[model samples]
Target: MSYDPRRPGEDKSQRAQTRERDDAQVEKAHRPDALILHEIIRREGEEEMRRTALALSLSGFSAGLTMGFSLIVPGVLKGHLPHEPWADLIVSMGYSIGFLIVVLGRQQLFTENTVTPILPLLTERTSGAFLRVVRLWSIVLVANIVATIVIASVLAHTDAFKPEVREAFAEISRHTIEDPFWTTVIKAVFAGWLIALMVWILPATGSAAPFIIILMTWLVSMCGLAHIVAGSVDAYYLVATGEIDLAKYVTGFFVPTLLGNVVGGVTLVSVLNFGQVAPDMEGQDRVGV
Candidate 1:
């Protein structure tokens, strides 16, 4: 008979302990293979992109209407701070209200999600995925802009808003129009970057996400950075009141801002995320392993 590996009447506790240690060591040495991280990011990007597009379309419309508060609040506050120029800044803080709601509540806001969903398509061979992502983005973005224009126009024409408040809205629009197209793009890029940063950081913070969002957006607004969706509120108001022509608003502000925002989110945040995980994945053979 072969020699027994275990002694009769022995507790076998040491053997159990040795086996556990071996298992623990194996687990500790196991690193995630590169392809897994790539696939995960890819799937996350595509799914998020599609879902985010829909969410953004709806959220953008709401943001458009809600962002009207940005225009209204500053002017409203200005009335109270009647004597101080700094009051203008104070009221702008109110503009962040809609953003905080949309971001924290998990509604897609367009610009931020632009970066996240494109990565998979960029790296994958999935058929129609790229087209679908683009199609969704185009649909949602156009709808959002149109909704903002219509809503802002209606509000501007009606007595629903007080005269000074309307004037403030118009004033904001005029200021935007005064900027060069390139300048607007630059501002939008900065805004998009900040928004993406907010998104990336929020996921890491469980309970304090809301506070982070509020703080980042407040800074975005206070810095006068232009956001494509949010800026549409001001732009639409301008177009609605005939203060700026439709062509100029579209070409000058909307298009450039959209491009800038895309660049900021995709080129900056998404790439950074990809880079962070790339180094840890080298030399791992792409096996079913």
Candidate 2:
């Protein structure tokens, strides 16, 4: 069916409708560009910085407590699944459960702070903004760690779970402290990078947010990435059970993972993304956008 040039009126009408539909489709598919994403995250940072210490602590503690489900779910799966190696793939899906809860629930997570607060700090470039970021990070991290300690101890010392599940927790948690210092740090860097990237992506995900969170977190789990908060659950579990002492947990897992997470989340995600959008943002500033 070829176009009939003689029927100009019909052709014009069809062409106009086609153009309208195409324009609508383009608008629908337009994800927020980098500059828009930067502004969104920067505003999120500002909001976070405004939170009172008590608010941040309570939220962070909830996040940390919720993160323990990453351990519980997988331990449950590992207990129920057949002993085949492929079973780990199934178990890994459970690892995303805690992340799904935390992300969707808007809990204050520490790794998320590594990127979110950094955005405003980069934009503001003031001592006060920097101090707020430091304050937020400090309070959130400590609160998260404290919550992890509480949960891990409960998982360790309580008879809350069945023997198999407890044993599964032990089996799973031992790996966190098994790695050498540098190795754990390297793993943590990847974990932090992925988690931060997930944070950056969330603003753009819209209805797919849960899927993205689960996918990224599951990858971290499947690859055995050493996330500071999630791994803290594991590390502290080991500590609680007397499998590893406090000194060992501190020197081996805590210090290195924390350092790596900061480096990975701040340097790899926040700094790089801010650098990418800074010029455009400055242009927006000049133009009063």
Candidate 3:
């Protein structure tokens, strides 16, 4: 007679063991893959698109207010350290502090929205969806800028920080505005690309999410890339201190950085990633955790 594994009266202990092993294997097979991660983040983006305007505005304002630490921490560091070539590297690491808090806190940062909202529009491809993306962008960007302006004014007018730290802030702002227009644009592109890539990789990072955010943002700072939200604080601080005129700040830094960031996040990161997975995403109905 041929041996049959499922024969009647099979050893009970052996059957139980076999079942347990099969269950473990099944669970392992269900772990998320790269495509699944893409779907997961895409779903998240769609949900964010559906949030109320007020909700987005509040979160964005909070993010902008909180991101001041990116400058503050670095300014403090630069204040304490003696001026040297390598001091910038150490100061750049301080730049990561604000990003960690903002991202981990789940606030609506405008840079992050660049990639997140684009995903929903890509999948839906409707005029309404396109408009919604624009609405979210406009609200978040304005809210963030307003918050930055408020914070910069307070820092400039009041003794919010020590003299050394305040001077450091002015020095940082001076360097930021001193960059040529095209240089700011190009650097902002790199910043935007990196920030969007951070969003894309976040779903797959699991517990290491904070480290990734810090690393990418630190790279942005170290490379002297312009970032709209963070750079807004720098620009506004210059205006507050009378170091640079409002018109120059807006026309020279804000406009180019904003355009460059949008191009980098939407065109380079969002569009390219969507194209890579669009062919495979057709049949999936819902993707989530």
Candidate 4:
């Protein structure tokens, strides 16, 4: 039954229905907005920035070591599978394993810093803040590369893996480094964008974080996108085994991919994300004017 606006009170059933609808609307409205997510990730970035250099270095190394599994698993899959179209699809799933390990373990992966450290810089806009971000990026990127070198050397010299697996690894490495310099750089930009996007989404995803990490990384692999950290493992493995010279690895693979990733993450993802949220943040700062 409808009630007149002038009535002192509505019918009991109608009033209860209205209250329930109002409560539901309020609950929906209070759910986290984009600005809220931005703040959550920014706070996390601040916390990470506060950690010591040694701590960051160790964690970055561990992340690099862990990322090795992305290559190893795909190698194993390719080793076991017949030379068929479907094999590539199955092998790409292995690319996500290392990412899952690093992300869930909370280790410092360099690509992640492309988004995280930049958040603080965006907020502070100071020379010191910029330098701190540079320091973190330098430490993490170098540590990741060092770990890749160590692991690639071990894999190259030791008989730890099966012969078939080693062959598969070589095949994967060759395929990765064979891309033209400019092509690799272009692909790496996409890889960087996807990885940075993954970091931005994680805090909001909660329990689904693992699936998000896997899906994004899997796309990176399937699409043949270059990623600086994971690609380092593939590129350096070839170097360790004398398949590619140091100059080729540095000029052909490393430098271009590094520049591409930085451009993609910093320019494409972080800057755009901040731009989207900055206006609302500024308005929030002013009150009772």
User: lDDT tens string, model 3, 1-289?
Assistant: 9744453675888877777787889876675665766677778888887889899899999999988888889999999999999998999999889889999999989899888889888888999999988888899999999998988888788886889999999988776777788888888899999999999889878898989998999999999898998888888988998988999889888998998899889999999998888767764544532
Which regions in candidate 4 have their CA more than 4 angstroms from the true location? 1-31
Alpha-carbon TM-score of each model against the true structure = 0.76, 0.92, 0.89, 0.90
Q: In terms of TM-score, which candidate is strongest?
A: 2
Please rank every candidate by TM-score, starting with the best: 2, 4, 3, 1
Collision pairs in model 3:
none
- Tens digits of per-residue lDDT for model 1, 3-69: 4445456477976776677789987667544345455546656776656556657755765566556
Clashing pairs in 4: none
lDDT of 4 by residue, 32-61 (tens): 777887898888888888889999999999
Q: Model 4, residue 136: what's the lDDT?
A: 88
Point to the candidate with the largest lDDT: 2
Superposed Cα deviation of residue 70, candidate 2 (Å): 0.6
Q: Tens digit of lDDT per residue, candidate 2, span 7-61?
A: 3565777877877777899898999988888888889889999999999999999
Per-model CA lDDT versus the true structure: 0.70, 0.92, 0.87, 0.89
**Model 2 Cα shift for residue 8 (angstroms):** 10
* Candidate 2 residue pairs in clash (backbone atoms < 3 Å): none
Please list the residue runs of candidate 1 whose C-alpha ends up more than 4 Å from where it truly belongs after superposition. Answer: 1-44, 49-60, 122-127, 281-289
Report how far off residue 43 is in candidate 3 (Å).
Answer: 1.5
| Model 4 whole-model lDDT (C-alpha atoms) | 0.89
